[model samples]
Target: MENWEAGWDDGEVGESSFDYSNHTKSQFLDDVERRLKLFMVRCVKVCRTLPGSYDGQHFGQQLIRSSSSAAANFRAVRRGRSQKEYFAKLSVTIEELDESLFWLETLVSTDLMPEHRLADLIDEGYQLLKILSKSRKTASD
Candidate 1:
C-alpha cells in the first residue's frame, strides 16, 4: 500500500500526522480559496470605481469572470466523481487562474491598477497555478 493508505490503516489521519510540508500539495488550498474569494470581491470594488472607458470596462469584466471562475472550478474539482473528471475540472481551474493573472498583469501594466496592490494578488495567482498544475498532473497519472 502507498504511504497514505498505510497511514490510514494506522489511524494516523489527523493534520499533524499528514506530512504536507516539504511537499507542494497543501491544506493551504482552503486558505487560498478563501483569499481568492476576498480578492475577487476587492477586484469588483476596484472595477466599480473605474471610469466609463472601453479598456477599463473590458478588463473589469474579464477580471471578475476569471477570478470567480478559479474558485468555482476548484469547488467543482473538489466535487468531481472520478479521477478523470477531477483532472478535467482542475485543468479548467488552472485556465481560470491563468486568465485571472493575465487580467491582473494587464491592469498593472496599463496603469489601471497600482503595482504594489496588485503584487500580492499576482503572487497568489502564480502559487495557486503551480499547485493546481501539480495536482492535475498527479491526478491524470
Candidate 2:
C-alpha cells in the first residue's frame, strides 16, 4: 500500500511554500493579489460545507463577505490613485481579512466546524494579514 498515512496533501499551502525573494516587486504584488482571490475561493468552498443551521448560515455569510471584500479591496489597492489612497485601501483589506479570521474561529468555537478542517485556511488568513499589516506600517513610516 502506498503509505497514505505519511503523505502530504497536494492541495496544502504552507507559509514556506512560496519563496518571494526571486520575484520582482510587480510579480510579488501580482502573486499577493492572486493569493487573496484564492483565499476567497477557499472560504467559499468551506462555507458551502456548513450545515444549514442558524449559526452556520450566519457566520458563513459573514465569512463570505469579509473574504471577498478583502480580495476586492486588495485589487483596489493595486490601482490606488495616490499614496494616501493606497494606504486607505490597504487598511480596508487588512480589516476585512481580520474579520474573515474572526469568522473562521467563530465557526470552530461554535461547534459548527472542527479546527483541523479550517486550520490551513486560518493559517493562510493570518499570513496575509501579517503581510498587509507590515506593508501598512512600512508605508506610514
Candidate 3:
C-alpha cells in the first residue's frame, strides 16, 4: 500500500500521519482556518481601538463581514462535492481576502488604525491572498 494509505483508519486519516504540505483536505482546511482565526483576532483588536463614530462603525462592520465570510466560505470548500464546487467556493474566499486586504489598507491610510499596530494583520491578509491566488490558479490549470 502507499505510505498515506497505511495511515488510513476505517475511512479517515489522522493529522499526525502526514505533513500539511501533503495537501490533504483536512490539513489544508486546518491551516486556512487557523489563518482566518488570526486575521479575525487582529481585526477585532484594531476595531475595538477605532473611534466610536459613524466611519469607524461602518468600516469596522465591513472588515468583520469580509474576514468572517472568508472563514465561512472555506468551510464550504471543505465540504465541496466536486472540483468545480471547490474552485467556486475557493474563489469566494480569495475575493473576500482581497476585500479584507483593501479594508486593512483603508484602515491604516485613513488613520482609523495605526500602521505599526495593524502591520501583522495587514501582512497576514496579503500573505493569504497570495496563497489562495496560487490555489485558484492551480485549480484552474
lDDT of 3 by residue, 21-92 (tens): 456656566776777777877776777778888988889889888988888887787788988998899899
Q: Model 1: clashing residue pairs? A: none
The TM-score measured for candidate 3 stands at 0.80
Residue pairs whose backbone atoms clash in candidate 3: none
Answer with 2 or 3, whichever has the higher TM-score: 2
Q: Of models 1 and 2, which has the larger lDDT?
A: 2
Clashes of each: 0, 0, 0
Task: Name model 2 segments beyond 4 Å from true.
Answer: 1-17
Writing each residue's lDDT as its tens digit, candidate 2 over 47-78 gives: 99999998899999999999999999999988
For each candidate in turn, give its C-alpha RMSD to the true structure in angstroms: 7.3, 9.6, 7.7
- The most accurate candidate by lDDT is 2
lDDT string for model 1 (1-141, tens) is: 211111121223322232344333234455545655776777677678665799999999998999888888877766778767877887887898899899889998998888997776677666656555655655655
Worst 10 residues of 1 by lDDT: 2-11
- lDDT of all predictions: 0.67, 0.82, 0.71
Candidate with better lDDT, 1 vs 3: 3
Query: Using Cα atoms with residue i matched to residue i, what is each candidate's TM-score against the true structure?
Result: 0.75, 0.87, 0.80
